[model samples]
Target: MSLPDPPAPIVHPAEYAFGDQVASAEEHLVGQVDQLLRTRFGKPVEAHLAAPTATDFAALRRWYGERAKGWQPLPDVEGAAKAGRGQGFGFSHGDQAFVMVWLTRDAAEGANPVTILRYGKAG
Candidate 1:
């Protein structure tokens, strides 16, 4: 006899922002990221925990900095950069556009610790 099929994983909505708050569970965050990638590039892109260099970090900083005022306070670019170290993902869809994501862990008790460092797009 075959075992029962496993239950589907639960995916919670993620709030993309820059801060020390727990954005969502790791699994949820991964799902959101994958969905975004698939929507933009027609395929899922995995995020890497590799640290970003100063230059690489700066590019993301600049991109987010330019549009920060319109959204939220110029997110702690330096902090995000530091947190993003070894925890960021970058993807491109030809010349159409590109997306970068940086994540930070929340230290709160029972917190998901998968907050988004930054989520921005560039062309």
Candidate 2:
């Protein structure tokens, strides 16, 4: 007997939206993300001049987390918005997770863009 085919990927709407935004925002966004996005995801990334709104950033973060190979919990934010600070998810692309990072329109500034994030491989 013949074997069955593999299942298709579950591409969520939010994931697609984020990809579109990233693509529209930059031509080599993937390269840029691969270079620096890693640092922002799990740390307090510095704010930029043209950073996106906190909500948008959080949305994108969630999307990233969904595809994460591994995720970790973080402390709760004492004052700032829940999305802005506190625990975050982590994932590994290959051998290393690098440094999960995210940038807003105002990331150039000294604003804390990074959060309590974690990354690794899932069992």
Candidate 3:
């Protein structure tokens, strides 16, 4: 069977002032997630861009939760660079670390599409 398509990279909301600052961090996160998806499912991770509506949010949550089963939320990201001004949540699968960055309180809402931002074997 083929793998499910991954979520697309999130588009920075208009409120963000300095998105370039986080470009590296964003790439790092994406890479990590892609690696995790490839390793776990034996296929390249595909990202699907979607609006943060109830249906989309639910689908995103279900997808991430299913993929992240047996994975625990990491308390902190070792060597994880501090985001200048963005807000997000982090989780872990064993030593692997994952992070989701966003500005809104409800990252599930507004324009947050790439909810599962990053995943990697934490250092």
Indicate which candidate wins on lDDT: 3
Q: In candidate 3, which residue ranges exceed 4 Å CA deviation? A: 1-59, 75-87, 105-123
Q: After superposition, how far is residue 17 of candidate 2 from its true place, in Å?
A: 25
| Per-prediction TM-score to the true structure, in the order listed | 0.30, 0.26, 0.35
RMSD of each: 15.0, 12.7, 8.6
Clashes of 1: 4
What C-alpha lDDT, on a 0 to 100 scale, does residue 48 get in candidate 2? 17
Please write out the lDDT profile of model 1 over residues 1-123, one tens digit for every residue: 111111112122254333333334344455544454454345432332322222244454455445433333322323333443423333232422233444443333222222232232322
Clashing pairs in 1: 49-86, 50-86, 51-86, 106-113
Clashing pairs in 3: 6-46, 6-47, 6-48, 7-47, 7-48, 8-47, 8-48, 74-91, 74-92
> Over the stretch 1-123, how does candidate 2's per-residue lDDT look in tens digits?
111111112111222233454444432322334334344343322211222343354564556555543433222221122233222233444433422333344443323223222223311
The alpha-carbon lDDT assigned to residue 32 of candidate 3 equals 49
Regions of model 2 farther than 4 Å from truth: 1-51, 70-90, 102-123
Best by TM-score: 3
Candidate 2: Cα lDDT at 62: 56
lDDT of 3 by residue, 1-123 (tens): 121334644443445332463444455554544443445434332232333433344354456557766676543322232332333344555535455533222444344334334333331
Candidates in descending TM-score order: 3, 1, 2
